[model samples]
Target: MRPFRATVFAAVVLAAVSVSVPVAAAAPGSGSSLPGAGPAVHPDNAALDCPDLLVVAVSGATDSTADRNPIEEETRQLWSNWVGNITVPVGEAKSRYPGSVGWMYVPYPATYGLGLFQDVPTYQDSVAAGVASTNRILDEQKTRCGDRTRFALVGYSVGGEVVERVARELGHRPADAHVGPDDVAGVVLIGDPYRPAGVDSLGAPGPSGGGFMSSEPADYGDLTDRIQHACRPYDIACDAPEEIAVLELALGVLGQMRFTLANPLQTIADAERVVSTMAARAAAHIVSGDDWWQSDESLLDVLRVVADKTRPVPDANLGPDRLREILDWAVGPGLPVVQEKLRAEGAGFVEDNSGVVELVLKPYIFLAFIQHIAYWNNNPHDPWYWESEKIVDWIGALAQEERERDSVGN
Candidate 1:
């Protein structure tokens, strides 16, 4: 395989550093009560308040526990790769406010396993489980703590995506939602794959590009201003360049494949969309007499292989062979015309920055791996600053505000 193709394949497979055991579902708020719990009172009567601020956190892929036992207060304090970042901050904020602040780290699969060679849940399945479990906790807390209690959400890596999804749902305030935008104090995300483009990172300037999975601007409705996203530069999870069509398509294809067994119909639909989009782009390139047809041809080759191997037929009866025949007829004969057009265009679409792409491609992907994992301790640009500290301070300040609010209300 060519260097670019080889690098792309490796990056997609190892994207986000996959490996995790599936976590069992635990009942919401199954953990012990917060410190300085008030006397038991009906939630409908009035605020049965103890903790004025609740910090709900979710850890990243492979950084969470599979055990469903109630997380003891002391165990919750133990340091972890990503969750430790939030816990230390929550602990600090709690110490300052005494019995006025509380926290819970939602437990879920937190896995990104491909499931191709293992029995573990896929990234898609893990994320969905995380979202479900996190929301269950949020719902339970809202009812138990009443409207007076405020919440701050924190998540890192895949956990960040989980939190982002939960926040988006809460922002929309669906009929079944237990928590709304008003109930949230703030949200903090680190190395989130769904981080939108152009949004300002917490402390420093973020990347020019958006997340690999979602490059478009995010909409959080009323919760928009209450959230803070911290993404390191070149972290492919949150800063993939739009110019790299190969990377995007590969991620889409692989990500969809992760959940194929869980939802085959959705997988077929998603695969069809990918192929159709590439087909359209290829046609446009050919019709416009663009020299980029070569690049498109390379991409089509990849899609063809995916279509051939996956045999993603909308109708199972059509059979993989039939689909392969259709794709062959669509692109095989047209290649000659595309090449002729390329020749007519003369020196078509020479990549002015081909060397740059080659030089940075592998390193960029490598850096993304390092940068995504290192947000807990390392900051490449500055050693004096850490993203975790920013989070700690933010959570502390929010907790203080919640404490003060409760004091005023009393």
Candidate 2:
């Protein structure tokens, strides 16, 4: 296989093309913040069909249901939370709007947990798919609803990454971009992996102080005002510093090498183990409320930290039954070993390097315990809970603003 560093640029570029969007680090137009110098369009929006108020919501990675896609699930939830679950029936919402409040779900890979080494390309493809699908939805919706439609966009996790790209695409209107600034009411991002450190977010702050898995600079262009990012604490996918990720990846490579030297056959056999561990770790950041573990040198020392950090959760107001139920959901089926280690060893080890051990072990702990996949159910007290609500509230507010504007215009 080619060296990992050599593959990085090519992979990123290919991923960019796959999503039909530019992934450049420089400001648009040679350091010019001006929109005129931004990257041109990838997905054509010429055929978009918009309504008076259109809301598009995309879900996090692997956030799909058997019948509904992630975007569809999120839209359904948003509508349910705001309208459907309320006294008003859902169908009544459509009638109340009268083609006013339209929503579209974008289709993408939404790959299941872990194996970043192999799955990154799939993510790129999913990004492309998401862009195309969203554009198509907009086109179809607008065609059916009319050109006067306004749009509100929301995304979570990798879905947040996709929405960021779409926002950038909208910012730099193609020569044929029929959708203008006026067409967008607002954009909401929840647990966004691409959320920059300094960017204004409504809810929890990003954990890493940097965007997830991306070292590139993000230019939201004109959409800056309307964009709001919600990243819970320690959600490295959204806030983990780029340096930490790079360090972890480097550690993982070393761990792979160490394992390969021990037994090449064993290393081959352990591919799934290593990849899944890494993926679990990455996913854990999105759900974990705290870092819970850190290292100065000794493995046992870090384990102590892990124990201390995790001890508080069970000791909280949570009762034994609720805790058991939560644990059942987290460690169900193929994940008992994760809980066993935390309860028994306090931490697990894969190599001499603490970081490597972390890569292999952290995921099991976080994935088994933390609530990463479900944001809609986040408790009101949790930092992410308010953030999630903030987005929904903003969408409703934006919709109301659009309606009032329409009323005044009429």
Candidate 3:
């Protein structure tokens, strides 16, 4: 029952003052298990019946009290709502193709809070848990399908981080383990934190130059060719720089002064507000057609959380104009410097490449107003959901092709 001390990414400006996040009372059945050695045991391979392709879907962060199962199920449902309509179910996939596509849910500790600070250990635990679940399922699928099953990974936000970790682990997999990139058909990542400047991308480029954890140069092993990253233009979660070192010192000072309150209740309340604002922005940016952000139950829940945690603090009297004035001061002089440095580094000045602009603007625009959450959702002629649907279609195609190959070999 020893606690794992995780250092938050200070550059992200969301690190908790306490620093040491306890892992007690987490989800059941997760501990020191090796990858592919948990929840995927299928001893009777002969009796097992499965689809031709297994789509392992992973979800992003949720509330600390949230269960992984429901999040996994929600991801599966997202696929069903978007992709399942295009093709037949696993039961009917065998007729049109060699076999059908099915979902393999990978459960992980999707602990919530400010990701850079409070959830580092949770992120690590999630990576281990997800990799373990995925590898186990792949092994079982191989055994049951007699080396015929193929894999397609689907991940969103932090879930995408877990997917990348799994892919990296597979690169160094032991010889005894019978799964590798060859068994993996395709990869679809939405707002992945590991997305860098130069990777196989599916849709628009990310805003920040690299992923949240990809400050250093790292590879996704053999899965690079099969992977497709989709990062929205304004989604700072994926596009913001891996390390905003230039801004961290000031941010750290402000975080200590503002976020770290003397009263425990106030601290908790402010943290919840940050998390809520983040969730609202994410939901606002990702939804489509209808103004789901206005009616989103999750957003409503976040509002309730914020309300319940309400308390007075410093800057309580600061109006919007005053807040804007402060922001202008913070980002005004530095914008040119940051932009110039990026240009010198050969970074483009376009919206997608200007991490500094997004880092400053997203909070004011996307995070502040629910009405402003219409970047990807409001447009009809240039629909944003297509970015996600395209990946789903690609996965379906990969599965079909692999199934066809297997059927031909049979």
Candidate 4:
């Protein structure tokens, strides 16, 4: 094997081992926060305390201290420095618009755990918390401010995922929701991991490749046109290539689990889904005689037979009484077969697609960290594009428009 392949395999092994271990739990009510959030433009007690526009900002994962317990960190109000990306624009908007605009900063766990090493909440937990907190605040504000106020959402990285999820829910206009599609003025996403390919950025054209988790189509429904996003070139979070799908999916699963230990059923469900999908794809490649196979289909067929034999009865055939039996089969006998198939087929696929992996995948994986974090600053390569400045300008324009509407109404 080549040096780069060896390195990739080693990293995958490390990640696999890391996610197997469990981390500590978060403190109660740690998911919700209003701390350091600026006051409403109108007084709390006013009968119709509605700002013409309200911007809700959600920050990405924060720095974790090894010395402190996870619980302590959860309770603290420490936000990620990336929040400056959101705050700067919001501050400028507020300064320009004054009483016409209001700001709410959501504080969440924002901790990305790395198993036994990093003592923090898992990526899933952190994002889940952010979505919950953001929605709660929106609901409260919508009820308090009445129908006159308009809402805009801003988020960076993981927070972008949260904002997108909330926006999707609102766009669908769920009956339980306090705010609907008409209530949202705009959504701004910076370095979102779920950004779709070919979508134009706030200022310029975005990357051709979609995000790591972009396999699932993002359905924002009515709010689709109102959304804007920015993903710098070579950023793996948003620009992952189709050639490295398996590797990207594996990394995504690890990030979702992290070290905080996800629920057993949820973890199994996720793992099963990933494994089955990979196996199905490999089977398709074999049938199509794709260059990656490099071997006879008989071997893969045998593996598939074994998997079929081990798989539990179809869910449609099972009753509530047999749910436990299916879960046991999924966790025990069924999962390992597909896992083994992935292990056997993944290396050969990579080896066959080494050219793309060398030129695109390697650079993307190596530079992802720097590219992901550098969105707040101007890209040295593309001097004309500065994500933060664009956001500030866009938000300020929104505020100005609201102010103008208010003036016209008066």
Best by lDDT: 1
**What lDDT does each candidate get?**
0.61, 0.46, 0.47, 0.58
Of 2 and 3, the candidate ranking higher by lDDT: 3
Residue 388 lDDT, candidate 1, scale 0-100: 72
lDDT of 1 by residue, 1-410 (tens): 00111244554564533442334433333453233323431121111233677777788766664442213332321223455545554565466446566667677766654333334554665677677778777776787777668888888888888898888878888645568888898999888877887578895678776776566678898899898998888777777664444555565455444443455565566567656755544443333333444454453333433432222322223346755754575479757755565564433223321223642755664677767755664233444567776787787788788878878888
- Per TM-score, the best of the predicted structures is 1
Model 3 lDDT tens row, 1-410? 01111123421232232223222224334442222323433221111345567777665554222233321222221112222222223223334443366664455554332232232333444445555655665666677675666778777665676677778777666656688767777777767665775444574443545554443455767776777777655455455554443332223222322222234565566556556654444333323213322332332222322321111122233457755754574488646644454444432213223345546755634432221111112123443455544664576677678667877988
In model 3, what lDDT does residue 293 have?
A: 26
Query: Which tens-of-lDDT digit does each residue in 321-353 have in candidate 2?
Result: 755754675667626644554554333333322
Predicted candidate 4 versus true structure: per-residue lDDT over 1-410, tens digit per residue:
00111244544553345333333443434433333322332221111246677777776655322122211113222223444444444554465445666666665666564444334565766676677777776776787776667788988877888797888778999545568887888899877877877567785787776666552467998898889988887777677663444454445455544332434555566557646754554443343432323443334333333232212222233345455765675578767744665677666566533435644535776766567766564233445556776786787678678778778887
**Against the true structure, what is each candidate's TM-score?**
0.64, 0.50, 0.53, 0.64
Q: Against the true structure, candidate 2 has what lDDT?
A: 0.46
RMSD of 2: 19.7
Q: Considering TM-score, which of the candidate structures 1 and 3 is the better prediction for this target?
A: 1
Give the poorly placed runs of model 1, Cα more than 4 Å off: 1-50, 65-70, 73-81, 115-118, 174-177, 258-362, 377-383
RMSD values, in order shown: 10.4, 19.7, 17.2, 10.9
Candidate 3 accuracy as TM-score: 0.53
Ranking by lDDT: 1, 4, 3, 2
Better of 1 and 4 by lDDT: 1
